[model samples]
Every structure is written in C-alpha cells, then in structure tokens.
Target chain A: EAGVAQSPRYKIIEKRQSVAFWCNPISGHATLYWYQQILGQGPKLLIQFQNNGVVDDSQLPKDRFSAERLKGVDSTLKIQPAKLEDSAVYLCASSLGGTTVRETQYFGPGTRLLVL
Target chain B: DQQVKQNSPSLSVQEGRISILNCDYTNSMFDYFLWYKKYPAEGPTFLISISSIKDKNEDGRFTVFLNKSAKHLSLHIVPSQPGDSAVYFCAASDITSNTGKLIFGQGTTLQVKP
Candidate 1:
C-alpha cells in the first residue's frame, strides 16, 4: 500500500513571501493532518481534517497560515508573508479513521522550508 | 505548557547492548501512548504503542513500559542494532476527547555504535 505523499521535498522562500505545500493521503484514509517540525523539536500539530471537514485547528496561526482539504483525499497548507520563524519542515500524515484512538498514522516525507 | 517531554537529547549505545529512552507526560487524561522512530530527512514511523491499562507491551526487540501513577513511560530496545539509530519520539492521546489528537514530546536522538 502506498503511503502519504507530499510535494516539493524542499522549499526556499524569502521572508514575507508566500508559500504553499501539498499533501495526498493514503487511499481510503479518512483523516489527514498537517504538522510543523522545527529544528531539534517534535512535530507540532497545525491542523486536522476529517473528510474535508476540519476537526481541529486551534494551534494554527490564522493570521498567516491556512489549510484546506476540499475532496477529503488531498490537502494544501499555505503560509502568507512567511517569517524566518516559519522555517521548518511541514509534515503531512493520515489515518484510516478519525474516531478511533487505535488508529495509526502514516506520515509522508515532509517539505522542508527555509525562509531567508 | 509542554505536556510531554523527553529530557534526554541524545543517547549512544554499543550494538548488541540495551537502549532505554524515557518520556514523561503531565496529563493524566492521556490513555494511549505511542513511540515513533525517524531517520534524518524522513518522517516519523510508528514503532510501538501501549495503552494505560497495560504496564508493558513488547514487539520484537522493542518494549514500552508505562507507569500511570508516575506519568512516565520508557521505550527499551534489546540488542540494539545499527539500523535502530534514529530519533525517537513519544506521543500521547486522550481517548476521552475523541478528537484523536496526539501530543508529542521533543524527541531523543539514539545512536547505536558497532
């Protein structure tokens, strides 16, 4: 079975510029998530989507970051006016269902962003 | 507040030896805990998990022990292998929330020397 897929394994952008990352989750997966991992730190959950509906986004920076999963299969995370502090790896993950605690998440090779 | 924490930033062990990595969480509501292993430039992969009801769970050479009263857990790898060198992260989820959200700790980097 194919795992979660992400695009632009690496990205570089100037401060204040806008950037976007894409994610395509595993087949038949019902839950998708976006996370940010700064250097030397664990991945921080940014947002979660359950079948195109947001389940949680309390940690997301609404002023600069936004994400959407229109069809429930693919997702896109965008950051506008990116700051140096936003330089980090963007990881996408998926699970079979959203209601179960036993669900194991499969992650994709993240998109490493470096804002200069 | 950082609910989960892995105080050790790194650990080195000779191959064929035992490796123990520890984690502590402040939240008592978390009932499920998981361990993930990650290689450089790669996303984390699920390794093992333990529910609060169980004190220990083992799979292959990896074992995870949970102490609910202490709010602590540890992952042990027996006869560590070179391939086991990676960053290990501990994560917890409060099943009562039904949100399926996982809280993760700053990972511990483990190196196995041959």
Candidate 2:
C-alpha cells in the first residue's frame, strides 16, 4: 500500500513571501493532519481534517496560515508573508477511522521549509 | 506552555545494550501515548504505543512503559543496534476530542555505537 505523499520535499522562501505545501493521504484514510517540526523539536499539529471537514486548527496562526482539504483526499497548507520563525518541516499524516481507543498515524516524507 | 517535554536532548549507548528514552507530560486528559522514530530529513515513523489504561506495551524489540500517576512515559529498546540511532519523540492524544490531535515532546536523539 502506498504511504502518505507530499510534494516539494524542500522549499526556501524569503521573509514576506508566500508559500504553499501539498499533501495526499493514503487511500481510504479519513483522518488527515498537518504538523510543523522545528529543529530539535517534535511535530506539532497545525491542523486536522476529518473527511471533507476540518476537525481542529487551534494551533494554526490564523493571520498567516491557512489549509484546505477538498473532497477529503488531498490537502494544501499555505503561509503568507512568511517569517524567519516559520521555518520548519511540514509533515502530513493519515489514519483510517478509529477502530480502537488509539489510532496509528502514518506520515509522509515531509516538506522542509526554510524562510530566509 | 510546552505540554510535553523530553528533558534529555541526546543519549548514547553501545550496541547490544539497552536504550531508554523518557518523556513527561503535564496534561491529565491524554488517553493514548505513542513513540515515533525519525531520521534526518524524513518524517517520524510510529514505533510503539500504549493506552492510558495499560502500563506497558511491547512490540518486537520496542517497548513502551507508562506511569500515568507521574505523567511519565518511556521507550525502551532491547539489544539496541546501530540502526536504532535516530530521534525519538513521545506524543500524547486526547481521544475525547474530535480532532484526536497529538501533542508531542521535544525529541531525544539516540546514538548507538558499535
């Protein structure tokens, strides 16, 4: 089975420029997530989508970041007027609908973003 | 505030020895905990997980132990091999939420030498 897929494995943008990342989840997976991992840190959830609707986006920077999952299959994350601090690895993950109490999340190769 | 923390940034162990990576969390609402291993430039891969109701979960050479009372959890690798060298992250999730979003700790880099 194919794993989660992400495009533009690496991206470099100047401060104040706009950038966008894309993700395609595994087939049949209903839950999708976007995470940001700064250097030396674990991935932090930026947004989550359940099927065609958003489940959570509490940690996302509303002023600068936005994401959308159309038809709940592929998703896009965008950052406008990037700041140096926005540099980080963006990861996409997907999991089948919850069966047990805990669900296993499979991740993609991740897109490394560097804002200069 | 950082809800999850891995106090140690790095650890080194000789091959064939055991490697223990620790993590702590401040939230009591977490119902599931997981461990993930990541290599440079790649995303984290799920290693093992333990539910809050259970104290231990084992899979092959990897084991996860949870101490809910202390809000501490650990990942233990038996007979650690050089291939196991990578950054290990601990994550927690609150099942009650619709998002089931995971909160992660700073990673611990493990170096296993032959």
Candidate 3:
C-alpha cells in the first residue's frame, strides 16, 4: 500500500515571504496531521484533521500559519511572513482511524523548509 | 515544560551487542508510549509500542519496557545490526483525554559499529 505523500520535498524562502506545503494522505485514512521538526529535535504536532474538520490546532500560530483539508483527502499548510525560526522540516502523517491512541501513523518523506 | 525527554543525545554499540535507548516522561497521565525510528531525510516510522498495563512488549529483536511508577521507558534492541543506526524518538499519549495527541521526546541517535 502507498504511504502518505507530500509535495515539494524541499523549499527555501526569504524571511517575511510566504510559503505553502501540500499533503495527500494514505487511501481510506480518516485522520491527517501536520508536524514541524527543527534540526536536532523530534517532530512537534502543528495541527490535526479528522476528515474535513479540524480536530486540534492549539499549537498553530494563527497570525502566520493556517491549514485546511479539502474533501478529507488533501491538505495544505501555509505560513505567511516566514521567520528564520520557522525553518524546519514539515511532515505529514495519516492513520486509519484517530479515535484511539494505539492507532499507528504512517508518515511521508517530509518537506524541508528554510527561511533565509 | 518538556513533558517527554530523551536525555542521551547519542549512543554507539557493536553490531552484535545490545542497544538500549532511554526516555522519561513527567506526565503520569500518559498511559500509552511508542518508539519511532528515523533516517536522514525521511520521516519517523513506527517501531514498537507499549501500554501502561504491560511492563514489557517485544517484537522480533526489539523490546519496550515501561515503568509507570518511575515515569520512564526504554527500548532494547538485541544483536543490533548496522541498519539499525538511526534516530530513535519516544512518544507518549494520555488516552483518557481522547485527543489522540502524542507528545514526542527530543530523540536519541544510535550508531551500530561493525
């Protein structure tokens, strides 16, 4: 079976510029998530989507970051006025069902973003 | 507050020796824990998991042990192989919250020498 898919494996942008990343989750998966991984650090959850609805986004920076899932399959995460601190790898993951903590999540190759 | 922590930044072991990675969590509410393996330029992959009710869970040559009272966990890989060299992350979840959210540790890089 195919795993989660993400676009633009790498990206570079100047500070204050805007950037967007895309993600396509595994087939039939009911939950999708976006995470940020700074160098030398483990991934941190940014937002979660169950179908077309938002499940959790408490860590998302509302002033600079936003996300949406359309048709409950594809998702996009955007950051405006990117800062140097925002440089990190963006990862997308999916699970069959997110109702339980036991559900294992599969991840994509991830998009590495750098802000100059 | 950093709830989950992997204190060891790195570890090295012989190919035929055992590799043990340690993790500690401050939240007692976390009832489920997991380990993930990651290679350069790739996202983390699920390795093994253990529930609070079980002290140990093993798969193949990998084993996970949870110490609820101590709020600590460890992953053991026996007869480690070169291919096992990667960053290992420990994650925990509070199932009672019903959020399905996972808190991850900083990760430890393990290297197996031939």
Kindly give the number of clashing pairs for every candidate.
0, 0, 0
Report the lDDT tens digits of candidate 2 across residue range A20-116. 9999999999999999999877899999888978888888999999999988799999999899999999999998867543678999999999999
**What is the per-residue lDDT of model 1 for residues B1-114, given as tens digits with 9 covering 90 to 100?**
999999999999999999999999999899999999999988999999999999999999999999999999999999899999999999999867666789899999999999
CAPRI quality level assigned to candidate 1 from its DockQ score: high
Which pairs, if any, clash in model 1? none
lDDT of 1 by residue, A1-116 (tens): 88899998999999999999999999999999999999988999999898999989999999999999998899999999899999999999999984565799999999999999
In terms of lDDT, the poorest run of 10 residues in model 3 chain A is A96-105
TM-score for each model: 0.98, 0.96, 0.98
Model 1, C-alpha of B72: deviation from truth (Å): 0.7
After superposition, candidate 1 runs with Cα above 4 Å error: none
Candidates 1 and 2, the one with greater DockQ: 1
Going through the candidates in order, their DockQ values are: 0.82, 0.75, 0.81
Residue range with the least summed lDDT across 10 consecutive positions in model 3 chain B: B94-103
By summed lDDT, which 10 consecutive residues of candidate 2 chain A come out lowest?
A95-104
What candidate 3 gets wrong by more than 4 Å, as runs, is none
What is candidate 3's local distance difference test score? Answer: 0.94
RMSD of 2: 1.2
Candidate ordering by DockQ (highest first): 1, 3, 2
